[model samples]
Target: MADLIKRIQQGERITITNRDAPVADLVPSASGTEQQTLDAIAAIKNARAGTITHAEFVAMHAKGRR
Candidate 1:
C-alpha cells in the first residue's frame, strides 16, 4: 500500500492484479485539464457501440442549460 501511494504521488499509473489478471487501475484524479477532456473524448470514441459528433456534444451541453 505504501508503495502504491509513493508511485501515485510520482504521477505514475499503476495496475493492480490478482493472480496475474488485472483487477483495477490506480490513476491520478483528473483536474479538469484539456488533456483530460481529450483523453475522455478518445475513450468515448473507442466505445464498442454508438457515437455522437462534436455538434451533438455541444447541443447536449446547451440543452442542459434550459
Candidate 2:
C-alpha cells in the first residue's frame, strides 16, 4: 500500500484491481484554477499587444442581457 501511494505521488497512474478486474484508478489532480489563471493572463497580454485594450475588451462584452 505504501509503495502504491509513493507511485501515485511520483505522478504514476495506478489501477487497483480486485481479483484481476480493475476496480479503481489513481492519478494526479488537475490544477484547474492555476491553469485558468494562466490562460486568462495570457489572453490579457495578447489582447493588449494585439488589437484590444482592457477597457475596450470590457466594453465589447455584454454588460447585461435583456
Per-residue CA lDDT of model 1 for 1-66, tens digit only, reads: 898887775568899899999999997666634565686666567543457667766765674464
Which residues of candidate 2, in runs, are more than 4 Å off? 32-66
lDDT per residue for candidate 2 within 1-66, as digits (tens), equals 898877775567888899999999987556744675686687678777886776867754543221
The window of 10 residues in a row where model 1 has the poorest summed lDDT is 41-50
TM-score of 2: 0.40
Global Cα lDDT for candidate 1: 0.70
* Angstrom error at residue 46, model 2: 18
Candidate 1: stretches off by over 4 Å = 32-66
- Report lDDT (CA) for all predictions: 0.70, 0.69
TM-score of each: 0.41, 0.40
